[model samples]
Target: MHNLYIPVIAILAAFAIIFGGQAISDSRVDDEIKSLISKQLGVDGEIELQAMKEVQKGYGVCGQYQVADQGQRFVPFYYSKVNERVTLDADAERYRRHCGS
Candidate 1:
């Protein structure tokens, strides 16, 4: 019963952001980025690819992804920024709380 609201909220939030963003990836780039993100999220092919591309920002190949069949619909996923200039560590507490990892 509680699982239904997540994707709905995600879809609604996507609509609000859809009009205010720039294109973030091309076909080839899409494949690469999705591969990286899927591994990072520990998924094989459960991500929403179209929505994945839409969420990435130009500043870096980073954005949120709508996870499928993972209980939570939206995951704020990211990777190193341009030129390896920035790298992020997972929030230990948050990971333990949400991901149990």
Candidate 2:
């Protein structure tokens, strides 16, 4: 089964590069994204971020945002590291286009 280990290792490595990179990138920008969301929404408390991945100029983030005690709203937002900005949009596809390549 030594041969079997090679494929398994390759698969595991691929997963690590794909997921691990995103995880690190997410943590680096999560706080800034949260702050921006809070400011834009004028909500207090925690802003939980879900899937965040590095895109072209920055990162594409989608998460549930709590507005006071009202409820949680699904928000699709983007953060451009180059521009140092956060954009909140209802449609992710549109946002992606606007965000550029």
- lDDT of all predictions, in order shown? 0.49, 0.68
lDDT of 1 at 65: 61
Off by over 4 Å in 1: 1-25, 49-59, 79-101
Report the C-alpha lDDT of model 2 over 1-101, residue by residue, as the tens digit. 89999999999999999999988966777878888888887877777776565666443443344444555666667766665567777465646664443
TM-score of each: 0.39, 0.55
Error of 2 at 55 (Å): 0.6
Give me candidate 1's TM-score against the actual structure: 0.39
Candidate 2 to truth, TM: 0.55
lDDT of 1 by residue, 1-101 (tens): 68999999999999767744423435555556566666765777666543332222454444456656665655554433344221123364432333223
CA RMSD of each candidate after superposition: 14.5, 5.7
